[model samples]
Target: MSISFRVSNSSKFQVSEFILMGFPGIHRWQHWLSLPFALLYLLAIGANILILITICQDSTLQKPMYHFLGILSVVDMGLATTIMPRILAIFWFDAKVITLPECFAQIYAIHCFLGMESGIFLCMAFDRYVAICHPLRYPSVVTSALILKAILLMVLRNGLFVIPVPVLAAQRNYCSKNEIEHCLCSNLGVTSLACDDRRPNSICQLVLAWLGMGSDLSLIILSYTLILCSVFRLNSAEAATKALSTCSSHLILILFFYTVVVVVSVTHLAETQTTLIPVLLNVLHNIIPPALNPMVYALRTKELRAGFRKVLRLGLKNK
Candidate 1:
């Protein structure tokens, strides 16, 4: 994939690379915004790595919840790394040009990781549901083997479903403008620049979002609904409080994830009025959750905090 400003052929139909306009109407000095974004990326990567190391070294956290949390940390790292570095380059160095192949790869990574994260959240909700609703069967039902199988399924399901998005997108003939209005190579952003019929790409992306994220969210809501029912049935307030407390962190993360997604989707319809809003939210959707997920878990979940302390103590003793 070569980055060339010149047309490859006499035909204007032949395009080589795309120019990413980091923020459409933002001022030049606003490039300083990269500082905070860089900090978020660093914190996200560092926290996720620490979470994974703590989970691996501590046998006490070898349960379904922590196993899923470990997978989430990995997904968070992938999600953040996929867009942050390139975006920072665009912001800091004005390196906005991306070859076609690289753009398509970013599109694929973003969709795949987003789908995987949604599936993981669903799995985590089921874990909470079982532990709260079916305490007697929780140990038997949510086994290590079962968590492994669920992880494999989440990976396979999301991977397979998201392949068509980038595949269909890449096949399209981008004959006209090659400048994308957003930082990352999003499906809609890239497809909008195509000179050919982008209906197929749009339809496929919409279908995948509904089938993958929509279904996962539905199941999550159902699981939490049942969990709420179970919690309310307990006779004592302390029991109810404990049960709800276990789920609060997960719920907060879920709210953060889907709220941005929904706002971005909704803003697209009215994009003409507020062009920068959707772009800003899309970038935030990728960075904010990853930066916050581990912190939320460590602060709210008792087991995770204990594991974090154990890892910190081990490090101190080693020194």
Candidate 2:
């Protein structure tokens, strides 16, 4: 069967580009909102970069957990870069016009990075599980080679699975309205603009999301469940406290990441009543998680905090 339906004579002009109608109902004065967003982008980028550099330079952080943390930092930066620049352009400069290729590229990057992040979270959960449940074997099990393999699998899985999303979106005939009422070129936001059959595109997206995120979330929960059970079995309260502390940072980051994703996923159901909420949350979801991930780690993880302090002290001594 043909991918796109034939355009009827009554159809409007074909859409070669889309206008991202960022944050509907917000007044022009709200363009000032760009200030906070830009600041957030800077903070997220700076924090993640610092984390990456520290992980690379600090030989003591050569373990699987810190390796995975470095991967997460990179993924966070990619996610932020994918969505933030375009959003800032819309908010600060009113450059909302996105060509078809550019929109598809953005959609692809968003989906790919999101999947990668979810996978990395799962890897981190496993790292925590091993550290708590089998500390002795962790050195043998979660080696640098294993971490490299996991990262490669994540990249391949998401990169291969998410390709169809933009391909299917590109196939649709967008002969109607070209205005996207969102900050970023998301799969649903862009697919909804197509004047032709969108059922395949929607189904493809839903399946991919569930398959990628659903499996990752399920495994992460199982890992944590086992970790908790193992923690409870410990006779010493101090031991238990130390064990749980290792996971606290990861749990917080996971909660924030998945909560925003779940809320954003279901926002379409109440889109009419909560017009700006969905769009606003969608933009914030991409930016906030990346910004908060490093902060949570720095504040909660002792080793990371110490590493950052060490880096700072060395720089000061150099000066």
Candidate 3:
């Protein structure tokens, strides 16, 4: 079940092992480079987890917006867990081999989380839309039951969309280069090795691009446009300024998140002799967004600023 289907019977595509090209040119300062990545990975997880805890424990943050923010933290953790461990392993250990099952699992986790994150972000945009554009009805519009249902649907959609990808991909023959050019089992990385015509896989990817990311980005854009229009129509300058500040956090988040997604999603055609550029971009695409999100939200949101202060005070008290 876990075997790579190679064309030739003599040499099965090495299922139990995969070759990883770790951070190129890191042999000289591998140890030094690892420290920063280690720190960043730790910070990324810590900050995101902290945000999750604050959102959950604080009664004031139990609203639909923070509820979704907490969910984003969970998704960020999922994304970070899927990538950072493999990335850290490459730096820590000399061995960069992954078993066939493990490799496919990584692919699944990566795609599923990314897809799910998109849906969640779209939900968040709509959440902001209701909160801002229709403030009077925001509570009724984004009820706890409705938020849960939206979250479940998003999770279910991403899960269903990406679930078959790795499975179908793993079933194909991989007699070609077993050495993956990236740190992890990237979707295109695995599919590139398959001897079978990857039209179906390509189609699936296109469907996801249009349906998952495309749809989400569109809705987010529309929400923001409406939000901006509403803000401008306000008579008070202070009110308009305050609205933009809130919108800016989401806009910044969207910029970082979607740029990488768009980059990697389209870079499939850019593969040539060396996958160095594409693979590096792919890893960056995953890591940078999750890493940037907490910082952006914390810096941009006054409420989040207050929460950080409160969290710090509580921590000091506990200490």
TM per candidate comes to: 0.95, 0.94, 0.90
- Best TM-score among the predictions, by candidate number: 1
Model 1 residue 274 CA deviation (Å) reads 7.7
By lDDT, the best candidate is 1
Check candidate 1 and list the clashing pairs.
none
Question: What overall lDDT, based on C-alpha atoms, would model 2 receive against the true structure?
Answer: 0.87
lDDT of 2 at 241: 97
Residue 40 displacement in candidate 2 (angstroms): 0.5
Question: How many angstroms is residue 179 displaced in model 3 relative to the true structure, after the best TM-score fit?
Answer: 1.2
**For all the candidates, what are their Cα RMSDs to the real structure?**
2.3, 3.9, 3.1
The TM-score of predicted model 2 comes to 0.94
Clashing pairs in 3: none
| Candidate 2 lDDT, 1-319, residue by residue in tens | 1122334456645667888878778846658889999999999999999898888777887778888999999999999999989988887788988888999999999999999999999999999999999999988999878888999999999999899999999888787678777888988778887778888987898899899998999999999999999999999999999999888999999998898889988996456443688888888988998999999999998888888888888889999
Expressed as tens digits, the lDDT of each residue in 1-319 for candidate 1 is 2435445444555578998987778846659889999999999999999999999999999888899999999999999999999999998888989988899999999999999999999999999999998999999999988998999999999888899999998877787678787899999898888778989998898888999999999999999999999899999999999999999999999988988888888887567533777988899999999999999998998888898899999999999
* Native-to-model Cα distance after best TM-score fit, residue 138 in candidate 1, in Å: 1.2
Better of 1 and 3 by TM-score: 1
- Residue-wise lDDT of candidate 3 within 94-200, one digit each (tens)? 56778778988898888889888888889888988887889899878899899889988988888888877787777677765676756788767777777778667
Q: Report model 1's TM-score to 2 decimal places.
A: 0.95
Ranking by TM-score: 1, 2, 3
Superior by TM-score: candidate 2 or candidate 3: 2
